[model samples]
Target: MSVKIEKAYILKSFVINESDRVISVLNEKGEKISLVAKGGNRLKSRFQGKLEPFSFVKVEYFDRGKGGLNSLNNVELLENLQKWIKGDMKKFFALSFLNEVTDRFVYEKERNSKIFRLIKHVIDSLKDGVDLKLAISYFSIWMLKLSGVLSEFNEEIQCLNEILAKPLDKLDCKEPQTIFNFGLDLISKNSDKPLSSADMLKNLI
Candidate 1:
C-alpha cells in the first residue's frame, strides 16, 4: 500500500540485531507502526539521525501483509528534538510518561484527529519552551478529555480554573500525583464517560 506519510514522529527505537532495530512511530493519521530498520543503530548509519526518538520526520513505506505494520522505504527528517531530548529530569519524565500513555492507548491504523492535534500541540509546546509542568498537565487534561476518558474542565473542583491559570512555580501541585487523583475524582463525579487506566491512576496516586 502507498500512502502519504502524514505527521510522523519517532517515538521509540531499539536494537534487535547487530545492524537492525525496531522502531515505533506515531503518525498524524494516529497510527502506531512497528518497522524494522537496517543498521539504524550504527554511529554513522543512514538512519542514525532520522530514527532518533522524538525527532519529527516525514516518511514513506511499503506493506505486504496486514494493514498496520509496514516496511519503511524512506524517510525525510523534519525536526530534530535533540535539544529538548535531554534536559531537566521532571520535564523529561513528564514527556516520556505522556508518550508512553499515548503509545498504549492509541490503536494502530485508527485515525483520531483530536489525538493527532493534541500531540502536535504537545510537541510544539515542548519545543517552544512552555512551562514544563503546565505543559504536561495541560496535555494530560486534554488527553483525557480527548480520549473520552475524562471530560470538560469543571469549575466545581477546588480552584481548578485558578490552578490552570496560575504559574507553575506559584501553584502547589504539592503532590502532583495526589492532586491529579483528586482532580480526576472531581471530574469523574461530573463526567459521564467511562474511566479507564486514567481513572485507575487515581488509585495509584
Candidate 2:
C-alpha cells in the first residue's frame, strides 16, 4: 500500500458503481495513468472539482504495480482549465478531440515529453483566445509528427515541420487545413482504433 504522488492533468473520467469513479490522466512523465476515486461522487468528497477533466492537479495515489488500478487518496488543484472551457463549445470540442486522440494513441506507461509539451501549449493557446481550428490543426500535425507517423521527406511535410519548430506563441496557424488533413490521413492509416470525438469535432467545424 505504498503511496506515490505526482503532478498530472486529468484527461477523462467515468463512474463505475455509482459511488466510485475511474480517472484517467497524463502524469508528469507523459504516461497514461488511471486512479480510482472512492466515493468521489459524494457531496463532501475531497476529490470534488479536483478530478474534473482538464484540471491540472498534484495527486497522491496507491501504487499497485502496473496491472492494478490505483486508488486516489488526495488531490491539490493547480489549474482550472474548465473555467476557460465554459460557453466555448468549439474550444471544448477541440480539446475533447485532442484528449481522445492522445488517450487512443498513447500507450500506458510510455513516455513522450514532446507530445506532452505540445498538448500543454495548445491548451494554453486555446485559453489565450488563439483560433480554435488553427490550434487543433497545428496540434494534430505536430502530434502525428512526434508520434513518427508522418513523413519528413515530403516538401510539404518539411515545411510543416519547420512551422512547428517556431515557438507556438509566435507561429501563425492560419488556414492549417492542409496539414490537418495530412495528419488525419496518417492517423487513419496507422491506427485502427477510432477517435470517439472525431465526428463531433467535424460537426462543430
Candidate 3:
C-alpha cells in the first residue's frame, strides 16, 4: 500500500469499537474521505487530540485503493476552531450546521476546489469575527451555487444580491433574518432528511 499525506478538515467522527474510530474529512482537494484510526479512542493514542470535528489537520494514511477505507497512520493538528467558540452556543450550532451541510452535499472522492476554498474562507471569516448570520447565509448560497441548484437569476435569492457580491468579512445585511430563512428553506428542500442542527439553530435565533 502506498502512503499519502494531505491537508484535511475533519467533518465528523464515529467510534467504531473500544479503541478504533472512523473519521470523515474533507481534504484540501475538496474530496470527502473516511479513514480508520487505530487506537484513536485510547487516552495515550497519538491521535488523541488531533481528530476532533472542525479541525484542520495534516493526515498520513495508507491508501488501500478505491472502494475501501484508508488506514490512518498519523495526524498533526493545524488548526482547531472548537476552542474559539467554546462557550458560545450560537456559534457552536452555526458551525455544526455548516459541517453537516458540507458533509451532506460533498461527494466522496470527487474533487471540487471551489467548495474546499469556500469552506476555508468561511471558517477563516468566523475566526476573524464576521457577522454570524451573514456568514451562514453566505455559505448556504455558495453551496447551492456550487452544487448547480442555484443561479444568479433565481428569483428567490434576488434579495441577496448584495450579500453574494461582498466578501464575508465585509458583508452587511439589513434584513439578515430574511436572507437566513431563504437560505435555510433552500437547504431544507435539497436535503433528503431533516438537518439535525436546523431546529437547534432556529430555536436559538
TM-scores of the candidates are 0.71, 0.89, 0.94
Quick one: ranking by TM-score, best first? 3, 2, 1
Instruction: Judge candidate 3 at residue 153 and give its lDDT.
Output: 35
Q: Compared with the true structure, what per-residue lDDT tens digits does model 3 show for residues 1-205? A: 8999999999999999999999999988899999999999999998988989979999999988785889999999999987888889998898899889999999888889888789899989988888777788889888888888864335554547776677788776777888887888788779888997877877886
Candidate 3: minimum summed lDDT over ten consecutive residues — where?
150-159
Candidate 2, 1-205: lDDT as tens digits: 6889998888898888878888999987888889999999878887887788877889999988765899999989999877887777777778787788888778888898777777888888877877666677677777777777645424544437555677556766543666556655565555667765666666776
Number of clashing pairs per prediction, in order: 1, 0, 0
Model 2 scores worst on lDDT over the 10 consecutive residues at 150-159
Between 1 and 2, whose lDDT is larger? 2
Candidate 2 positional error at 29, Å? 0.9
- Residue-level lDDT of model 1, residues 1-205, one tens digit each, is 7644555777778888888877788887777777776667678887767877766788776754485457776788888766766675555555565566667657666667767667777667667766554555555665565567544555565535545556433555534544465544544454455445344443332
Of candidates 3 and 1, the better by lDDT? 3
Off by over 4 Å in 1: 65-68, 151-155, 158-205
Candidate 1: deviation at residue 41, Å? Answer: 2.8
Evaluated with lDDT, which candidate comes out highest? 3
